[model samples]
Target: MPPSPVVPCHSPVPDPSLYEPINTLKPVVPDVWIADGPVVRMAMPCGLSMPFTTRMTIVRLRDGGLWCHSPIAPDDALFAAIDALGPVRDLVSPNQLHYAHIAAWKRRYPHAVARASPGVSERAAAQDIEARFDAAFDDAAPSPWPGEIDPLLFRGSRAFGEVVFFHRASATLVLADLIENFEKEKLTRGMRAVARLGGVLDPDGKAPLDMRMTFTDRGAARDCLRQLLAWKPQRVLLAHGRWYERDGVEQLQRAFRWLE
Candidate 1:
């Protein structure tokens, strides 16, 4: 049997629109799940902080070791619920901007290897954030979960890169920052305007305009996008904003239409 979708909790959140009942696993499919977390304030280049709704994906590998992607802020009850699922063996940081909580998770699961995308180390150092990774993702899939999950190193941007994952059994695609779909109602008026300007608001969310500017080599990004499309995922999970539970391929194509 698959793990329960949620664990009982009573704490109230400031914004239910941001996906309430936070920090509990919600099953997406058998052996695959997602946990929505509280909003995190992200500093922007414009000298202001932007609020982003956080989410994380969890996959229970065939061997019983859990693969955690872009783990959200750690919570005691959440950790206990995760403990019931299985042993955590992989803590994955999908992109340079999404590794903030890996250090904390690593401290809790010492045996789990923290894997990162390119440039994460430098980013952490520049930001003065302590993020230690035991392994780095490259062109080839790494050990432990290769046959079960497909890993892709999305290249092209010299300053930004992401390691995308696909869970074969669940037909789910896990991404960080590639596409963000913030629901308008969930966001404050100012944030909604900002999100609209960033091209990340729901129903039409794409890569942030600023992030798109970093991809000087659109060909390389297009190549990676091709691979992602070929995966034919049925569900797509994002680290921020609303996730697509169906029509994953269509959503991917829609989100990346800007690449064409």
Candidate 2:
């Protein structure tokens, strides 16, 4: 028997009209849309902080397929935008704990494949939702992105698994819930103090704390970090907080300094 279905904590959806359509030609990292034919990166700004803040990324495959890294409950307008773009090919629950809107996405896109980490199967089963994956991410796991992207599983801790994705064509790395970048003024006073103490805040004001908590074994994390660094990606797309542009690999090294 599967574990009981876990209903995600509910939150109101943000109005889409409030967001201005960002021109992709610009070079802003936070809400920049990078597209190369069928491969499109839509940087939707989240309401994590006031005055246009983004905490997650929604990637669109060539077939108009959608894949989200972070959980943001898709409202009608959001779904319409997704529909306008193309069909949602897959929904990935990168870690065990981040399945906030998997069920809803499954309902919305019934044909879309729902892939999750090891424990996600039971959670999906409990909810009576069917999830399909080519394989669970093991060491050096392969992604199902049809040669467009590759996934490397960073194994070292049991609390959660962080599957890192590398988009080959764009030389961009997609990370989930691992690194966070929040401006101090945008965060609440309490959060600011905690982030500062956690060494999440970089000199450029980026936060990597989201990825730091999952490392039960530093050795494993260090090895994974080393492997990821070898890719030499130019852009870093993260699920939480902000994405890094230029010197992404160096920023990643700085964030995972425990490995050093």
The global C-alpha lDDT for each of the candidates, from Candidate 1 onward, is 0.90, 0.58
lDDT of 2 by residue, 42-65 (tens): 222221322223333456665556
Model 1 agreement with the true structure over 120-168: per-residue lDDT tens digits: 9889999999998999887764644767999888877867888889899
Whole-model lDDT, model 2: 0.58
Number of backbone-clashing residue pairs for each candidate, in the order shown:
0, 4
Worst 10 residues of 2 by lDDT: 35-44
Error of 2 at 84 (Å): 1.2
Residue pairs of candidate 1 with colliding backbone atoms? none
- After superposition, the stretches of candidate 1 with alpha carbons farther than 4 Å from their true spots are 1-14, 141-144
Q: Give, for candidate 1, the lowest lDDT window spanning 10 residues.
A: 138-147
Overlapping backbone residue pairs in candidate 1 total 0
Best by the TM-score measure: 1
Per-residue lDDT, model 1, residue 117, is 81
